[model samples]
Target: MTDTHSDDVRPVQPLQPEQLGTYFALMEAVSLLQHQVEQQLRAEGDISYVQFQLLARLAHGPGPLTMTDLADGVVYSRSGLTYQAGLLEKAGLITRGPAPDDDRATLVTLTGAGRALVARVLPGHVEVSRRLLFDPLTDDDVRHLGDIMTRVRDHMRARPPRSAAPRKRQRS
Candidate 1:
């Protein structure tokens, strides 16, 4: 491991057993939870998890979101978001157009169908989440978990991921 204070190559220390166990547990739990959530979304709304995220964010936003905004919010690649937006637009669930204020930006907005889809799938989503994630935790445990995750997320977001950056043009 390289020391944070100095740039020197050093031996990496292995994680403690407890730390390793906790890391594995976190990964497994997230994987399982995401799988179930994806299944629920697919069954109910015929949408992928990312697509649902896109729609849900649009539904909750005060107004339209630019494609870049959506990419940052969803932590998805700009190309992938554009493709998904195209699919959603074709389905009449969403509409994408040039931003009124910025011609270079594409704004995404949920249509009635998108809103209705969110409304339709939300109950199952909530039920699945509550049953799988919250049922076993006490109120205090839930609060503590939320606090911990919020801190971790904020720390990670401090350095935005590569996907959050604007894409560069390719030479043709």
Candidate 2:
């Protein structure tokens, strides 16, 4: 306790070059893996991964979904989803129609061609998914990783807003 003032302070250490290199290497690995997967899908099915994802979502959705709903389901921003949907529509894989309840909103539906394409690709997709993610992990590891990811997603969703909630005055 004699001279604690200066002694208590610690110098900040900068990240080492190796640590930075590792981060870059990890990012490169993920990018390369995604590219490989995309190549495989394109070669086998003649469909891009994003297109496949849209088809899959449309196939699984309850009937026709609005453009906004499709965007939400695919986790794409509205504009991006719209662009992709337009591409799919041009490809004759999906169709767009006016929403039943809202004339302004458009509903997206999977065409027969889209359903057939998904059917053709699903087996390969499942195999790839299994090989990439599940085959290497033990059941407990997979369960734990899924749980952790879900927690992270939920935490992100539950972050408090900067603005305060509105309150109503009580009468005595």
Candidate 3:
């Protein structure tokens, strides 16, 4: 009889070299761009990437948002966003007020200083983004990349969560 634990001893299927190459290229490109932007923001302005993103989001927001709403807007985890919010609050870049409807939740708003900072940094940020991301790509390439990325994102989102059981192998 087969041992019950045999189910756990599955052979590993390696990704094809091309698939691995694509994954690495995408990751490296994103990492390098993020590092470059982070350095620029730090050197030109005294702000961490998360802090910059938080301020930028708030500046563009239609109205004040709770910490949870801000976290969702920026796709950050709630705990990390809260910590960043604290830093911004300490810097006088943002203000937290008791939510009118909900005493428990605080509404975060960009202060005048925060808005000014975003206005000051936005030109440089746009130039950097254009230089690093857009200038190199042809208009067609930009369109194609956007379309492909959207499709990939949607496809991934549509997939069901992975089961706890090991994935079954496809038969030839």
Residue-level lDDT of model 2, residues 23-100, one tens digit each, is 687579668666766777798889888888888888876778888766655566666878888889999999999988
Which regions of candidate 2 deviate over 4 angstroms? 1-33, 157-172
lDDT of each: 0.91, 0.78, 0.82
Q: Write the per-residue lDDT of candidate 1 for residues 1-172, one digit (tens) a residue.
A: 1223356556567778888889899999999999999999999999999999999999998879999888888998878888999999999999988898998899898999999999999999999999999999999999999999999999988996656566688999
Query: Which whole-number lDDT from 0 to 100 does residue 98 have in model 1?
Result: 88
Best by TM-score: 1
- Provide the lDDT at 63 for model 2: 77
* Residue runs of model 3 more than 4 Å from their true location after superposition: 1-14, 153-172
Answer with 2 or 3, whichever has the higher TM-score.
3
Better of 1 and 3 by TM-score: 1
Name the lDDT of candidate 2: 0.78
Candidate 1's C-alpha lDDT? 0.91
Q: Each candidate: how many clashes?
A: 0, 0, 0
lDDT, model 1, position 169: 84
RMSD of each: 3.4, 10.7, 8.8
